[model samples]
Target: MSVLPLVFTSGWASGINAYAVVLLLGVFGATGLADEVPESLQRTDVLVVAGLLFLCEAVADKIPYVDSAWDTVHTVVRPVAGAVVAALLAGTSGSLPELAAGAVGGSTALMSHLVKAGTRMAVNTSPEPFSNVGVSVAEDLGVAGVITLAVFHPVAAAVVAGSLLLLGMVILVFLASRIRRFLRRRAQRREERSLAGAGRHRPHG
Candidate 1:
Protein backbone atom coordinates (compact mmCIF):
# COMPACT_ATOMS: atom_id res chain seq x y z
CA MET A 1 0.00 0.00 0.00
CA SER A 2 1.01 3.60 -0.54
CA VAL A 3 2.54 5.33 2.49
CA LEU A 4 0.33 8.36 1.99
CA PRO A 5 -2.38 6.98 4.25
CA LEU A 6 0.07 6.36 7.07
CA VAL A 7 1.46 9.82 6.53
CA PHE A 8 -1.98 11.30 7.01
CA THR A 9 -2.64 9.20 10.08
CA SER A 10 0.72 10.10 11.63
CA GLY A 11 0.14 13.76 10.86
CA TRP A 12 -3.23 13.73 12.57
CA ALA A 13 -1.84 11.85 15.51
CA SER A 14 1.09 14.27 15.70
CA GLY A 15 -1.29 17.18 16.01
CA ILE A 16 -2.66 15.61 19.15
CA ASN A 17 0.66 14.27 20.49
CA ALA A 18 3.69 14.60 18.27
CA TYR A 19 6.04 12.84 20.65
CA ALA A 20 3.81 9.84 20.98
CA VAL A 21 3.54 9.46 17.23
CA VAL A 22 7.29 9.73 16.82
CA LEU A 23 8.08 7.39 19.68
CA LEU A 24 5.59 4.80 18.52
CA LEU A 25 6.82 4.93 14.95
CA GLY A 26 10.37 4.60 16.16
CA VAL A 27 9.52 1.55 18.18
CA PHE A 28 7.51 0.00 15.38
CA GLY A 29 10.37 0.50 12.98
CA ALA A 30 13.00 -0.72 15.38
CA THR A 31 11.01 -3.81 16.11
CA GLY A 32 10.48 -4.53 12.43
CA LEU A 33 6.73 -4.33 12.70
CA ALA A 34 6.41 -1.95 9.76
CA ASP A 35 8.89 -1.85 6.94
CA GLU A 36 7.65 1.42 5.57
CA VAL A 37 8.89 3.32 8.60
CA PRO A 38 11.95 5.42 7.82
CA GLU A 39 15.30 4.24 9.15
CA SER A 40 16.00 7.68 10.59
CA LEU A 41 12.92 7.38 12.79
CA GLN A 42 14.21 4.10 14.21
CA ARG A 43 17.41 5.55 15.57
CA THR A 44 18.14 5.19 19.28
CA ASP A 45 18.69 8.87 19.92
CA VAL A 46 15.42 9.77 18.23
CA LEU A 47 13.50 7.22 20.30
CA VAL A 48 15.07 8.52 23.51
CA VAL A 49 14.13 12.11 22.85
CA ALA A 50 10.67 11.22 21.65
CA GLY A 51 10.10 8.98 24.67
CA LEU A 52 11.07 11.69 27.15
CA LEU A 53 8.93 14.28 25.42
CA PHE A 54 6.03 11.84 25.32
CA LEU A 55 6.33 11.27 29.05
CA CYS A 56 6.38 14.98 29.71
CA GLU A 57 3.28 15.47 27.57
CA ALA A 58 1.54 12.57 29.30
CA VAL A 59 1.81 14.50 32.54
CA ALA A 60 1.33 18.08 31.34
CA ASP A 61 -1.69 17.21 29.19
CA LYS A 62 -3.73 16.24 32.23
CA ILE A 63 -3.37 19.62 33.84
CA PRO A 64 -5.70 22.56 33.20
CA TYR A 65 -4.05 25.86 32.33
CA VAL A 66 -0.72 24.10 32.21
CA ASP A 67 -1.95 22.09 29.25
CA SER A 68 -2.84 25.28 27.45
CA ALA A 69 0.60 26.67 28.16
CA TRP A 70 2.14 23.47 26.92
CA ASP A 71 -0.05 23.60 23.85
CA THR A 72 1.06 27.14 23.21
CA VAL A 73 4.66 25.97 23.30
CA HIS A 74 3.92 23.07 20.95
CA THR A 75 1.99 25.13 18.39
CA VAL A 76 5.01 25.01 16.14
CA VAL A 77 6.68 21.83 17.32
CA ARG A 78 3.90 19.43 16.39
CA PRO A 79 3.29 20.60 12.84
CA VAL A 80 7.02 20.67 12.14
CA ALA A 81 7.45 17.17 13.45
CA GLY A 82 4.57 16.02 11.31
CA ALA A 83 6.03 17.55 8.19
CA VAL A 84 9.48 16.08 8.79
CA VAL A 85 8.16 12.63 9.55
CA ALA A 86 5.88 12.64 6.55
CA ALA A 87 8.67 13.75 4.28
CA LEU A 88 10.93 10.99 5.58
CA LEU A 89 8.20 8.40 5.13
CA ALA A 90 7.55 9.54 1.59
CA GLY A 91 11.23 9.65 0.77
CA THR A 92 11.56 6.00 1.63
CA SER A 93 8.24 4.86 0.10
CA GLY A 94 9.10 6.05 -3.44
CA SER A 95 5.53 6.91 -4.56
CA LEU A 96 4.50 10.15 -2.91
CA PRO A 97 7.01 12.98 -3.17
CA GLU A 98 8.57 14.52 -0.07
CA LEU A 99 7.31 18.05 -0.67
CA ALA A 100 3.76 16.86 -1.21
CA ALA A 101 3.96 14.68 1.86
CA GLY A 102 5.30 17.53 3.94
CA ALA A 103 2.55 19.86 2.79
CA VAL A 104 -0.20 17.38 3.47
CA GLY A 105 1.21 16.46 6.85
CA GLY A 106 1.91 20.00 7.95
CA SER A 107 -1.50 21.38 6.97
CA THR A 108 -3.37 18.45 8.48
CA ALA A 109 -1.36 18.78 11.67
CA LEU A 110 -1.95 22.51 11.97
CA MET A 111 -5.72 22.16 11.60
CA SER A 112 -5.87 19.28 14.03
CA HIS A 113 -3.62 21.11 16.45
CA LEU A 114 -5.91 24.13 16.35
CA VAL A 115 -8.89 21.91 17.05
CA LYS A 116 -7.12 20.17 19.92
CA ALA A 117 -5.87 23.42 21.42
CA GLY A 118 -9.25 25.10 21.11
CA THR A 119 -11.05 22.13 22.62
CA ARG A 120 -8.63 22.09 25.54
CA MET A 121 -9.13 25.81 26.00
CA ALA A 122 -12.86 25.28 26.30
CA VAL A 123 -12.47 22.22 28.51
CA ASN A 124 -10.15 24.00 30.94
CA THR A 125 -13.08 26.25 31.81
CA SER A 126 -14.47 23.42 33.91
CA PRO A 127 -14.23 23.75 37.68
CA GLU A 128 -12.70 20.34 38.12
CA PRO A 129 -9.61 18.83 36.48
CA PHE A 130 -11.24 15.45 35.95
CA SER A 131 -12.53 16.42 32.53
CA ASN A 132 -9.07 17.50 31.49
CA VAL A 133 -7.65 14.17 32.56
CA GLY A 134 -10.36 12.30 30.74
CA VAL A 135 -9.85 14.23 27.55
CA SER A 136 -6.08 13.84 27.69
CA VAL A 137 -6.31 10.12 28.20
CA ALA A 138 -8.74 9.80 25.33
CA GLU A 139 -6.43 11.73 23.04
CA ASP A 140 -3.43 9.61 24.00
CA LEU A 141 -5.38 6.45 23.33
CA GLY A 142 -6.76 7.74 20.07
CA VAL A 143 -3.33 8.69 18.79
CA ALA A 144 -1.77 5.40 19.81
CA GLY A 145 -4.59 3.25 18.48
CA VAL A 146 -4.83 5.00 15.15
CA ILE A 147 -1.08 5.05 14.60
CA THR A 148 -0.81 1.36 15.38
CA LEU A 149 -3.63 0.62 13.02
CA ALA A 150 -1.96 2.76 10.43
CA VAL A 151 0.98 0.38 10.47
CA PHE A 152 -1.17 -2.62 9.61
CA HIS A 153 -4.04 -0.94 7.78
CA PRO A 154 -3.13 2.50 6.57
CA VAL A 155 -6.34 3.20 4.65
CA ALA A 156 -8.55 2.20 7.55
CA ALA A 157 -6.55 4.30 9.97
CA ALA A 158 -6.62 7.27 7.61
CA VAL A 159 -10.40 7.01 7.37
CA VAL A 160 -10.69 6.96 11.15
CA ALA A 161 -8.27 9.84 11.49
CA GLY A 162 -10.15 11.94 8.96
CA SER A 163 -13.46 11.23 10.68
CA LEU A 164 -12.07 12.19 14.06
CA LEU A 165 -10.50 15.33 12.60
CA LEU A 166 -13.84 16.37 11.12
CA LEU A 167 -15.64 15.67 14.37
CA GLY A 168 -13.08 17.67 16.37
CA MET A 169 -13.39 20.62 13.99
CA VAL A 170 -17.18 20.60 14.31
CA ILE A 171 -16.98 20.47 18.10
CA LEU A 172 -14.44 23.27 18.12
CA VAL A 173 -16.70 25.46 15.98
CA PHE A 174 -19.60 24.79 18.32
CA LEU A 175 -17.49 25.68 21.34
CA ALA A 176 -15.93 28.76 19.79
CA SER A 177 -17.60 31.06 22.29
CA ARG A 178 -16.37 29.11 25.27
CA ILE A 179 -12.83 29.10 23.91
CA ARG A 180 -12.97 32.86 23.50
CA ARG A 181 -14.20 33.23 27.03
CA PHE A 182 -11.38 31.06 28.24
CA LEU A 183 -8.87 33.26 26.46
CA ARG A 184 -10.42 36.42 27.86
CA ARG A 185 -10.34 35.03 31.36
CA ARG A 186 -6.70 34.05 31.03
CA ALA A 187 -5.82 37.49 29.77
CA GLN A 188 -7.74 39.07 32.61
CA ARG A 189 -5.87 36.98 35.12
CA ARG A 190 -2.51 37.97 33.65
CA GLU A 191 -3.46 41.63 33.65
CA GLU A 192 -4.66 41.44 37.22
CA ARG A 193 -1.44 39.79 38.30
CA SER A 194 0.57 42.41 36.52
CA LEU A 195 -1.33 45.21 38.21
CA ALA A 196 -0.90 43.55 41.58
CA GLY A 197 2.85 43.22 41.00
CA ALA A 198 3.04 46.88 40.00
CA GLY A 199 1.15 47.88 43.10
CA ARG A 200 3.61 45.96 45.26
CA HIS A 201 6.58 47.66 43.60
CA ARG A 202 5.06 51.17 43.66
CA PRO A 203 6.94 53.96 45.51
CA HIS A 204 5.71 54.46 49.09
CA GLY A 205 5.25 57.90 50.70
Candidate 2:
Protein backbone atom coordinates (compact mmCIF):
# COMPACT_ATOMS: atom_id res chain seq x y z
CA MET A 1 0.00 0.00 0.00
CA SER A 2 1.11 3.53 -0.70
CA VAL A 3 2.13 5.83 2.14
CA LEU A 4 0.43 8.91 0.73
CA PRO A 5 -2.75 8.34 2.67
CA LEU A 6 -0.81 8.08 5.91
CA VAL A 7 1.10 11.19 5.00
CA PHE A 8 -2.11 13.12 4.43
CA THR A 9 -3.56 11.89 7.71
CA SER A 10 -0.41 12.92 9.53
CA GLY A 11 -0.59 16.33 7.92
CA TRP A 12 -4.12 16.78 9.25
CA ALA A 13 -3.10 15.63 12.71
CA SER A 14 0.01 17.79 12.66
CA GLY A 15 -2.03 20.90 12.13
CA ILE A 16 -3.91 20.26 15.36
CA ASN A 17 -0.83 19.09 17.29
CA ALA A 18 2.46 18.58 15.50
CA TYR A 19 4.26 17.37 18.58
CA ALA A 20 1.64 14.70 19.22
CA VAL A 21 1.83 13.52 15.63
CA VAL A 22 5.61 13.37 15.83
CA LEU A 23 5.63 11.55 19.14
CA LEU A 24 3.03 9.02 18.06
CA LEU A 25 4.72 8.31 14.74
CA GLY A 26 8.07 7.95 16.46
CA VAL A 27 6.62 5.45 18.90
CA PHE A 28 4.99 3.54 16.07
CA GLY A 29 8.28 3.39 14.16
CA ALA A 30 10.38 2.42 17.15
CA THR A 31 7.98 -0.35 18.16
CA GLY A 32 7.74 -1.87 14.65
CA LEU A 33 4.03 -1.17 14.51
CA ALA A 34 4.34 0.50 11.11
CA ASP A 35 7.11 0.07 8.58
CA GLU A 36 5.93 3.00 6.53
CA VAL A 37 7.16 5.42 9.18
CA PRO A 38 10.70 6.71 8.61
CA GLU A 39 13.64 5.56 10.77
CA SER A 40 14.58 9.21 11.32
CA LEU A 41 11.31 9.68 13.14
CA GLN A 42 12.30 6.89 15.53
CA ARG A 43 15.55 8.43 16.74
CA THR A 44 15.89 8.71 20.50
CA ASP A 45 16.56 12.42 20.39
CA VAL A 46 13.58 13.02 18.11
CA LEU A 47 11.26 11.11 20.43
CA VAL A 48 12.53 13.00 23.47
CA VAL A 49 12.01 16.43 21.94
CA ALA A 50 8.61 15.53 20.55
CA GLY A 51 7.53 14.14 23.89
CA LEU A 52 8.55 17.28 25.77
CA LEU A 53 6.84 19.57 23.29
CA PHE A 54 3.70 17.47 23.36
CA LEU A 55 3.54 17.83 27.13
CA CYS A 56 3.98 21.58 26.87
CA GLU A 57 1.24 21.83 24.26
CA ALA A 58 -1.08 19.66 26.32
CA VAL A 59 -0.96 22.18 29.17
CA ALA A 60 -0.93 25.35 27.10
CA ASP A 61 -3.79 24.15 24.92
CA LYS A 62 -6.17 23.83 27.89
CA ILE A 63 -5.97 27.48 28.86
CA PRO A 64 -8.31 30.07 27.40
CA TYR A 65 -6.59 32.63 25.15
CA VAL A 66 -3.31 30.82 25.80
CA ASP A 67 -4.14 28.11 23.25
CA SER A 68 -4.68 30.76 20.64
CA ALA A 69 -1.25 32.17 21.40
CA TRP A 70 0.26 28.72 21.13
CA ASP A 71 -1.55 28.14 17.86
CA THR A 72 -0.25 31.46 16.54
CA VAL A 73 3.28 30.39 17.35
CA HIS A 74 2.75 27.05 15.58
CA THR A 75 1.32 28.59 12.43
CA VAL A 76 4.60 28.01 10.61
CA VAL A 77 5.93 25.12 12.66
CA ARG A 78 3.03 22.74 12.00
CA PRO A 79 3.06 23.09 8.24
CA VAL A 80 6.81 22.71 8.11
CA ALA A 81 6.68 19.60 10.25
CA GLY A 82 3.93 18.15 8.08
CA ALA A 83 5.90 18.80 4.91
CA VAL A 84 9.09 17.33 6.27
CA VAL A 85 7.34 14.21 7.56
CA ALA A 86 5.54 13.73 4.27
CA ALA A 87 8.72 14.17 2.29
CA LEU A 88 10.49 11.61 4.44
CA LEU A 89 7.64 9.14 4.06
CA ALA A 90 7.60 9.59 0.31
CA GLY A 91 11.33 9.23 0.09
CA THR A 92 11.14 5.97 1.98
CA SER A 93 8.41 4.29 -0.11
CA GLY A 94 9.52 5.57 -3.51
CA SER A 95 5.85 5.29 -4.51
CA LEU A 96 5.15 8.97 -4.94
CA PRO A 97 7.24 12.00 -5.80
CA GLU A 98 8.64 13.67 -2.71
CA LEU A 99 7.93 17.20 -3.83
CA ALA A 100 4.28 16.49 -4.57
CA ALA A 101 3.82 14.76 -1.24
CA GLY A 102 5.44 17.66 0.55
CA ALA A 103 3.10 20.12 -1.13
CA VAL A 104 0.05 18.09 -0.20
CA GLY A 105 1.17 17.76 3.39
CA GLY A 106 2.14 21.40 3.79
CA SER A 107 -1.06 22.76 2.26
CA THR A 108 -3.27 20.43 4.29
CA ALA A 109 -1.50 21.41 7.49
CA LEU A 110 -1.87 25.11 6.76
CA MET A 111 -5.61 24.78 6.11
CA SER A 112 -6.18 22.65 9.18
CA HIS A 113 -4.15 25.04 11.33
CA LEU A 114 -6.27 27.93 10.10
CA VAL A 115 -9.42 26.09 11.11
CA LYS A 116 -7.99 25.30 14.55
CA ALA A 117 -6.81 28.85 15.13
CA GLY A 118 -10.09 30.38 13.97
CA THR A 119 -12.12 28.01 16.12
CA ARG A 120 -9.96 28.77 19.16
CA MET A 121 -10.42 32.49 18.60
CA ALA A 122 -14.18 32.05 18.56
CA VAL A 123 -14.08 29.83 21.62
CA ASN A 124 -12.07 32.40 23.54
CA THR A 125 -14.96 34.82 23.17
CA SER A 126 -16.77 32.84 25.82
CA PRO A 127 -16.35 33.75 29.49
CA GLU A 128 -15.77 30.26 30.91
CA PRO A 129 -12.53 28.29 30.74
CA PHE A 130 -14.02 24.80 30.77
CA SER A 131 -14.87 24.91 27.09
CA ASN A 132 -11.26 25.58 26.20
CA VAL A 133 -10.10 22.58 28.19
CA GLY A 134 -12.80 20.42 26.67
CA VAL A 135 -11.89 21.44 23.14
CA SER A 136 -8.19 20.88 23.76
CA VAL A 137 -8.81 17.41 25.14
CA ALA A 138 -10.97 16.55 22.19
CA GLU A 139 -8.28 17.69 19.75
CA ASP A 140 -5.58 15.68 21.52
CA LEU A 141 -7.67 12.53 21.49
CA GLY A 142 -8.66 13.08 17.89
CA VAL A 143 -5.03 13.44 16.83
CA ALA A 144 -3.95 10.30 18.66
CA GLY A 145 -6.88 8.29 17.33
CA VAL A 146 -6.35 9.38 13.73
CA ILE A 147 -2.60 8.86 13.76
CA THR A 148 -2.94 5.40 15.22
CA LEU A 149 -5.64 4.54 12.72
CA ALA A 150 -3.47 5.73 9.87
CA VAL A 151 -0.87 3.15 10.77
CA PHE A 152 -3.28 0.21 10.60
CA HIS A 153 -5.62 1.48 7.92
CA PRO A 154 -4.25 4.33 5.91
CA VAL A 155 -7.14 4.71 3.48
CA ALA A 156 -9.74 4.72 6.20
CA ALA A 157 -7.73 7.19 8.24
CA ALA A 158 -7.40 9.48 5.25
CA VAL A 159 -11.15 9.40 4.77
CA VAL A 160 -11.70 10.26 8.41
CA ALA A 161 -9.11 13.01 8.35
CA GLY A 162 -10.52 14.50 5.16
CA SER A 163 -14.01 14.51 6.64
CA LEU A 164 -12.72 16.26 9.74
CA LEU A 165 -10.84 18.82 7.69
CA LEU A 166 -14.00 19.60 5.75
CA LEU A 167 -16.08 19.85 8.91
CA GLY A 168 -13.58 22.21 10.53
CA MET A 169 -13.55 24.43 7.43
CA VAL A 170 -17.34 24.60 7.53
CA ILE A 171 -17.29 25.45 11.20
CA LEU A 172 -14.73 28.16 10.57
CA VAL A 173 -16.93 29.72 7.90
CA PHE A 174 -19.84 29.83 10.34
CA LEU A 175 -17.71 31.32 13.11
CA ALA A 176 -15.81 33.87 11.03
CA SER A 177 -17.85 36.84 12.19
CA ARG A 178 -17.74 35.71 15.80
CA ILE A 179 -13.96 35.39 15.68
CA ARG A 180 -13.62 38.84 14.17
CA ARG A 181 -15.90 40.33 16.82
CA PHE A 182 -13.91 38.62 19.55
CA LEU A 183 -10.63 40.04 18.25
CA ARG A 184 -12.11 43.53 18.00
CA ARG A 185 -13.42 43.36 21.54
CA ARG A 186 -10.08 42.08 22.83
CA ALA A 187 -8.23 44.93 21.12
CA GLN A 188 -10.70 47.43 22.53
CA ARG A 189 -10.16 46.11 26.02
CA ARG A 190 -6.40 46.34 25.66
CA GLU A 191 -6.64 49.93 24.43
CA GLU A 192 -8.94 50.88 27.30
CA ARG A 193 -6.52 49.35 29.80
CA SER A 194 -3.62 51.18 28.24
CA LEU A 195 -5.41 54.54 28.40
CA ALA A 196 -6.43 53.97 32.01
CA GLY A 197 -2.86 53.15 32.95
CA ALA A 198 -1.62 56.27 31.17
CA GLY A 199 -4.15 58.45 32.98
CA ARG A 200 -3.09 57.05 36.34
CA HIS A 201 0.54 57.83 35.57
CA ARG A 202 -0.07 61.39 34.32
CA PRO A 203 1.04 64.34 36.52
CA HIS A 204 -1.68 66.30 38.28
CA GLY A 205 -2.13 69.97 37.34
lDDT of each: 0.95, 0.93
lDDT of 1 by residue, 102-146 (tens): 998988898899999999999988999999999999999999999
TM-score of each: 0.98, 0.94
**Model 2 C-alpha lDDT per residue in residues 18-102, reported as the tens digit of each score:** 9999899999999999888889999999999999999999999999888988998999999999999899989989998999999
> Model 1: runs farther than 4 Å from truth?
none
Alpha carbon RMSD to native, model 1: 0.7
Cα RMSD (angstroms) for every candidate in the order listed: 0.7, 1.6
| Cα TM-score of candidate 2 | 0.94
